[model samples]
Target: MARRNHTTELGSIACDDLTELGAGKEGWLVDNPNLLTALDTHSLAIANHSVVLVLDWSDGSDPTGPRVKIRPTLSPIESEYISSVEWLVFDDIRVLALGTSCGYLLIYSLRGDLIHKQIVNPGRILKLRVRGTKRDLTEDTSSAEICVVMPGVVARFDGSEIQSMLQRWFQETHSQFWDQKKNPVDSGSSNVRLPYQLWNVNKYGSCADAAITGIMPPPLMELQSSQRYYCAVTIGDDAVISAFRLAWWDFTLC
Candidate 1:
C-alpha cells in the first residue's frame, strides 16, 4: 500500500500538479494538472494536450476557492501534446504560450483565444524562456522577447508584435462589430491575420561537434549599450561553451 504525504507551507495551497505561475502576491495565478486559476480581472491559461483552459478565480467574496471556468474554441491541429507553457504579462494584459512536442509554438490571449502559432524548429523544443525587460528608457519602444531552444538551434520571436496582435484581437472580439458580417475581400485579406514570425537568428552547431544542450541570454545590464547588442551562450554535449553576439546595427555599416 502507498501512502501520500500532503504537507504545505503556511498560506500555501496544497494542490496536485501545481506546475507554474507568474510572480505576484495580491492575487495568484496557478496551473494544476487539469485546472488553472485566475483572478476576476484576469484569466488563468493552461494547456492540456492541445486544448487551452482559461479559468476565472474571482468570487468577489473568496478568491482562494474555486470560481468559474471559460472554454475557448481551438483548432484541431492546435491541440497537440503540449511540452511546456509560459505566461507573458505586458502591463495588464497576459498572453499564454504553449510549446508542442512537434516543434510548434502556440500563443494565446488571456481569454483563451489562439493568437498565433508557428513551427519554430525542426526538432522538439526543449525549453521556452521570455527574456529582456518589459519596459526600456524609451517609453515608445518594446523590449520584451521570447526565446525557444531546441536540440541544436535557438529561435527568437518578436514579443512586441505578439502583444500588438493580442491587443487587436481582444479589442475586436469585444467590439460590437465582432459578429457582424463582412465582405469576402475584407475577411480574406492576409494583412488582417496575425503574423507568427520566428526568426532563426542564431545557431549552435559550430560551437562543438556534439548536440547542443542548453541556451541562455546574458544579463540585461550587459546588453545595454549605445550599440544595443544581445549575447547568447550555449552549452554543447561535448562540454564546450560558445558565446554569440547579436547587434542591432549591421556590422558592415559600422
Candidate 2:
C-alpha cells in the first residue's frame, strides 16, 4: 500500500481536481473543495479563458483577492469529466488543452485576461488517451503534445504531423517494472519496490484504467506559466505531493 504526505503551502489553493472536495484525512486539503489549504503559489486553468485560478499558500492565512466561483461550463450537450490538462505557450499568448475523461480534447486561449474555448477534432479516432508525466522536461512540444499510446502504438501532434514516436521509444526505453526478480518466495532475493505499473487509458475516454505507479506519482492536470509548472497529485489511497517541470510548446503555429 502507498501513502501521500502533505506539505505546507503559502496561503490558499484553488479547486482543480476536486470541485468541492479535499484529498485525504490527514491532509490539509482533505476533502476540501473550492478552497485550497497549505498550497504554494500556484494557478489553475482549463482550456483558454481569461482569469487564471491563482493560489499562493505562502502566507498560511486566508486569500485576499476578490472571490471567484468556478462554475462548470454548462451546456445542453452532456460532456464527460476531465482526465488531464496541459498548458501551452504560443509566442505571446498562452493556450490550454483540457483532455476529457471521454477522450475529447478542448482547446482554450488564455491571452491577456480572458479564456476562449474551442473543441478540437482528432478525426478518425474513436477514442483518445490523455495523460501527463513529470519526466518530460522541455520548453517545446514534447511536453505539450498529448501523446496517445496504444498497444504497440504511440502518436503525437507535431504541428500538422501526427508523429509516431512512443512505439519506438517504448521499445527502446520502457520495459517491465521488475526483471531482476529471480525468486518470488525468497524475500531476500528481491526487495519491495514502488508501484510503477504501466496502465492504459479507459476505453470510453475516462481515466478509469489509469492505475497508480512509481514511488512518487505525478498529477494528472499540470499548470504552467512562463517557465514554471505546478502540480497537485497523489499516490494510492494516501496522496503524496510534489512539483514537476514540463516541456514548453511551440506557439509559432497560429
Candidate 3:
C-alpha cells in the first residue's frame, strides 16, 4: 500500500511537469486547443507554436530530459506558428515533420537538427500526412506520398524526393563540404522537390481537411494497367463528407 501511494504521487508530479513543459510561454496548454502530438515506433513528439519536445519510449523508470527539444528559430518579423506535426518514418530512419500557419514544412532529425524547410502552400497547413500505397505484390512495387492539407487545398509530394535527400545526407562522409551545400536552396537540382500537383477540392464545399486517400487503376475504363487515378476525400463543417475522382483532364464530382 505504501509503495502504491508513492508511485501514484510520482506519477502526479510527472504529469504536472509535462503539462508545464508543453504549456509554452502561455502557462496553460488549453490556451491553444490545437496543440500537436505524434507517436511512432521510436518516440512521442509534442509541439507548441515553434517548439517540439520528443519523449523517449520506455517501459522502465529513468530520469532524463526529453530525448530531444527542437525549437525552430523564428525571426522577430515572422508571425508564422506551427499548426500540425507528424512522424515521417522510413525503413531505416524517421524524422519529425511540422507544418506552420504560414505554409511551411520543416523536417528535423531526431538529434534536434533541422534538415529541411520549404514553403508548401500560401495558406495555413492543417495536417502533414504520410501514406503508402501498394501497387502490386508480385511486381514488388509500392509508393509513398506526403499530403499537405490546407483549408481548401491538398498538395501531394512525392516521397522519393525527400527519401533520396535523406539517403545522401546520412551517407555523407565529408562534413564541411556537405554542410556548405546541404541546404537545398543553394543547389537547384538537389532541391528535394519534383513535379507535384495541387488538387482543388473546394468546389464542393469548404474543406476543413482533405487528402488523396489512394490511387488505383482507372475505374470503369478499359485502359492500360499503367494508368492510375486518385481518390480525393474531404470533410467540412458545411458539408459532412465529400469525395472526388481526380485525373489529368479534370476532377469528377462523385
Pitting candidate 1 against candidate 3, the one with the higher lDDT is 3
Better of 1 and 3 by TM-score: 3
Q: TM-score of each candidate? A: 0.54, 0.33, 0.76
Candidate with best lDDT: 3
Candidates sorted by lDDT, descending order?
3, 1, 2
Candidate 3 lDDT by residue in tens digits, 4-94: 4443222211333466355436545566575688987546787888778777645463545535677775544768788899998777778
**RMSD in angstroms, candidate 1?**
10.0
Candidate-wise lDDT, in order? 0.52, 0.31, 0.71
Q: Provide the clash count, candidate 2.
A: 35
lDDT of 3: 0.71
Q: Candidate 3: which stretches are off by over 4 Å? A: 1-32, 58-62, 75-78, 173-191, 219-225, 248-254
How would you encode candidate 1's per-residue C-alpha lDDT over 1-254 as one tens digit per residue? 89877984223332332333322333334334432322224345444544444544434434355522222233466443666667777667776676776787766554344556666655566567776653545576656677676666565665777677767766765583477633322321134433332323235453222221222344577854455445566666666777656444432220
C-alpha RMSD by candidate, in order: 10.0, 20.9, 5.9
lDDT of 1 at 167: 73
Per-residue CA lDDT of candidate 2, range 1-254, in tens?
Answer: 78776875434444353333433445534332323221112444322121223333333434564433233242325444444445544333343444443334443332221132323322212223333334344543332234432221123443211112222222322253234422212211112111111222222232211222212323456443344222212222223332222222311121
Provide backbone clash counts, one per model: 1, 35, 0
